[model samples]
Target: MSQRSIKITMSAVLLAAATLASTAPAGAAHGGEPLTDVRVATHFDLAAGQMPENITLLPDGTAAVTFAAGRQVALVSPGGGTRILATLPAPADGGVHTPVLGFPLTTGIARTPDGTVYVLYATGTADLTGLWRLRPGQDPQRIAALPADGLPNGLALDAHGRTLYITDSVLGTVWTVPTTGGTPTAWSTASELAPTGFLGANGAKVRGGALWVTNLDRGTLLRIPIRSGNRAGAPQVKASGMAGIDDFAFTGRGNEVLAALNAPNTVVRIRPDGTSTTVLDAADGLQNPTSVALRGKDVYVLSAAYTTAADPNLLRAHLRGHR
Candidate 1:
């Protein structure tokens, strides 16, 4: 990336962070009841110099995390132990540098039932932008190439696991590729997906027979019906008014979801009826929560804590009262 582009990108991200800091409430409490039994599972200080961004839990009770600054994929054992699973090649310039904080690169990850892992990264270089997959004992393989301007940030897989959906934050476009390997096609590109600045669609998922995505800049959650022949129906807003929405996960209820509000460091629960409530916030000690994952009755959150990467964390909280 050129110096001019880097300046523009950094300014946008800084502005978003500043906006959240200025407007968000300082305390931990929100209107709704807070989530229960919140605990820290892992802290980045142990993985020194690494900034953990996104996570995908493996079937064997371990989590695969993408270290945006460390440039690697690591497995976090249930006991809080972490080890590098695969080291991705360093991207050009290794992403932009910001004082005190870490780079804003390499953010999303997903795993197939068969143990295959998919990662999204942007190096501001043509050949290094898009999704890559790592099979057991195999090297990282580029599955598809996104546009040069694409900033791929979140990933999701369909029910049959035949298709993979990726969200591009910079371009506000969603691309789909066959899980087993095929041409990546533009799945959706409506006006609703347009980027307001640097963030457009940040996180995506397939649940309850439809494709759901979050617009980080718009503060809206959009639902698009998955029609016959793998096509997308007209998009509709499911929920909005969120701040710095990054990634989200379903709560296993009808249409309820948990979202990470990065700027203010909060997690919110959104219902199918479009109502939202804070489930966790700064009072809960959350700092730049980037993504949320659920396993059984427990919810896991990964925080980037952009203010300083020294203590970014992985937190666990009990799932409660979602019907």
Candidate 2:
């Protein structure tokens, strides 16, 4: 073993390392996709400093985003730009934002056909959280508010917009409230329809008469019927094995759904039957992405909290509209 031999061995080891890196899937650490594109879809980056709690798409190619810690709402462009909307009130102010909501939580957001915006807030207090509605010009309103002793999160509308379905993470179930804003009827009042354990049921959206849910820890996608009792059926696992998924969106009538994998920061497309493929990877697709929304070909993702002990500034990415 002389100098020449040592040098040759070192070179060989370096080459092997590079080869392995090239072949490995992106987001392998958290189980997600690889980086590929550079389409900073939004105009402003919300990736680093702000913790995006949730995002909902608007028809005009924009999206409403909620920052959990900042307690602010943002109107995000189809590409990657962001505009801050109104902040929400605390439960002390009568709106949902109490014990029931998860910690540092933005919870969820939804929009009505008439352009009414509703954002769900959790106060970390089990009994004080519910829903907050914001109109175009007036102060925000609270619709379908729960009793001071209840919890609510993950909001969704039925196929016809008649009912709003919500998932309570702590309660481990989904509930429905009428559109006119009255007492909420338990959509799946029975525990049999709700999942349990590492199933991690959260982030629900109704599409095509079915409910789509993101399983927080187990890394899965779940589907359940909106109607309960005789009309309600047991929940099923629609898709599974995702990477820290948070939110997802489906094309108007297409079978494709783009799911957000938050931890590794990526997006993946899954078919109606549960097969999936990587559409966006972490290194390139996003950084700490929390939620996703789609209108036509455009896909919107919110990048939350990329800053570290070395960096404190915020960051974000906006992918252009896709068909």
Candidate 3:
């Protein structure tokens, strides 16, 4: 089957599951307090290929985002002004060699305090498949080489900004590389990161001395400790039952997180105890929320509209008393 067909089939299955889950009694599938003042901050141009796949926040409150299909990196200011920072070169065959998705796309992104940006690109070809770095006033450069056959998805930077942890969905592996860029090391290949039939290891973050990741196919959140020698320890299941989960953000209140459920068209708050509740849904302008980022009480969500085929937008909301 074609990639598009596979995506549609997966969406249908996940949508049905979400529908049933949504009907569950309160505090069961939906438990946490929903967000407030949810509003669209910016509506992207679908025709122009401006679907945002992932996002990272800058100190100035601007969001650095990767336009997945467009293969571009852009900055959206707090006031909703957008500026294209860089666009990756298109593959000669127009990404026909790409795996899984069968098309070239940018995925996870992270920014450093010094204005350096790192993003992941998957093309199923060696030349342009790996991590890219963009320094202030300079063009983007491919830093490390990843497996052409694997789909590199979510990314996270350690607290000191000296290391980068990347998740490969197709390979069911977590890779570690220096921020400066070099050969990547297979950090972990736990069974939990493996995909059941579709994508896995979708979103990743580093916090509290641990690397947290989400498995889309497994519908789980996993935590792997940063053991001695900067190695990955045993994988621990943090949360489960959230099918179609994409990217997530730490709410800073312990292990509480707001995760985007792509095909389900919702954002859920998952607590440390594995309980989760619907915090935002399609009514909040989410067309297939791909990622979430939080700054203080402010929340940002990027919806790609991949399956919805409607509005791909950036949404802002308040967490209501969250510091």
What TM-score would every model get versus the actual structure?
0.88, 0.73, 0.93
TM-score for candidate 1 = 0.88
lDDT value, residue 244 of candidate 3: 82
Per-residue lDDT of model 2, residues 1-323, tens digit only? 12233224323422332233344344324234322244555433333224565777677767787776556677866454667777765544433334322233456888889887777766644343567778888776667665443435578877676777877655666767766676666666444323343224567788666787776555667777655432556677777666356677775546667777655445777768877766665445465455666555445566553321121112233333432
Q: Write the per-residue lDDT of candidate 1 for residues 38-114, one digit (tens) a residue.
A: 98888875244356778888876788988765667888898889888887776556554321122435668999888
State the lDDT at 9 in candidate 1: 47
Off by over 4 Å in 2: 1-38, 43-49, 77-81, 91-104, 126-128, 147-151, 189-199, 227-231, 306-323
Q: Which 10 residues in a row give candidate 1 its minimum summed lDDT?
A: 95-104
**Winner on lDDT (2 vs 3):** 3
Candidate 3's displacement at residue 148, Å, is: 0.5
Model 1 per-residue lDDT at 264: 61
Give the lowest summed-lDDT range of ten residues in model 3: 23-32
Which scores higher on TM-score, 1 or 3?
A: 3
Kindly list the per-residue Cα lDDT of model 3 for residues 1-323, writing each as its tens digit.
23354346436645643554454332333344657888999999776678899999999899999988888999999999889999998888778677667678899999888889999999888999999999988988999999999999999999899999999998999999899999999999999999876787889999999999998877789999999899899999998877788899999899999999887788998888988888888887999899999999999999998777789999999997786
Report every candidate's CA lDDT: 0.75, 0.58, 0.87
